[model samples]
Target: MVIGILKMDICLPHLHSLKDKRKVLKSLMAKLRQKFNISVAETGGQNKWQRSSISVVLTCNDSGFAHQVLEGVVREVENTIEGFLVKYEIEII
Candidate 1:
């Protein structure tokens, strides 16, 4: 099996509170999970209102497919999310 991990550091310039952060993160996570059929969560920066770190995990039989899915996830997030994607990394193992 192949395991792919995608980690994203994002900056939410418009968010003013934890409530706003949670709302945006929840929607983003839910959308990613449903669309990619993978696991998504806030892995860091939980206490900060304007910064977030999100991790997405995918398990599959093909590494190429996993990488492709991760790339698609990144594109979707960058296009649709309210925050700026500061950086991202993808690892396959």
Candidate 2:
């Protein structure tokens, strides 16, 4: 099995508090989970109001497919999310 992981750092410039952060993050997480069938969560920057780190994991039979899926997910996040991307990394194991 091929395991793909994606880590994203994002900035919510318009957010005012943790509550707003949760709202935005929860919506993005739900969209990604529903659309990609991947496991995702907030992995870092939990106490910060404007910054967040999120992780997504997937299992596939081939490495190329795994990479492709995560790449697509990144684009989806960049396009659909209310916040802006700070940085991202991808790994296959």
Candidate 3:
């Protein structure tokens, strides 16, 4: 099996509270899981209300498929989140 992991740093411009941050993060995570069949969560920057770093893990039988799926998920995230900027890195193991 091939495992693909992607770590993304997302910046939310107008998030004011932890509740709002959690709600946005939850919605983004749900969308990622539903659309790409991947597991995503906030791996870092959780204590702050404006910035979040989310990590996504995708497993598949083929490395190529895993990469494709990760790429698709990244694109989906970029398209779905408004005024959100992301810096991401992907690794296959």
Per-residue lDDT tens digits of candidate 2, residues 4-90?
999999998899999999999999999999999999999999999999999999998999999999999999999987779999999
The better-scoring model by TM-score among 1 and 2 is 1
lDDT at residue 92 of model 1 (Cα atoms): 100
Model 1 stretches with alpha carbons more than 4 Å out: none
Tens digits of lDDT, candidate 3, 1-93: 899999889888888988999998899899888888888989999899999999999888999999888889888888877647568998999
Which portions of model 2 miss their true places by more than 4 Å? Answer: none
Please give the TM-score that candidate 3 achieves against the real structure.
0.93
Q: Which is superior by TM-score, 2 or 3?
A: 2
Against the true structure, what is each candidate's TM-score?
Answer: 0.98, 0.97, 0.93
Q: Which candidate, 1 or 3, would have the higher TM-score against the true structure?
A: 1
Task: Report the number of clashing residue pairs per model.
Answer: 0, 0, 0
Q: Ranking under lDDT, best-scoring first? A: 1, 2, 3
lDDT of 1 at 49: 97
Output the number of the lDDT-best candidate: 1
The collision pairs in model 3 are none
lDDT of each structure?
0.96, 0.95, 0.88
Better of 1 and 3 by lDDT: 1
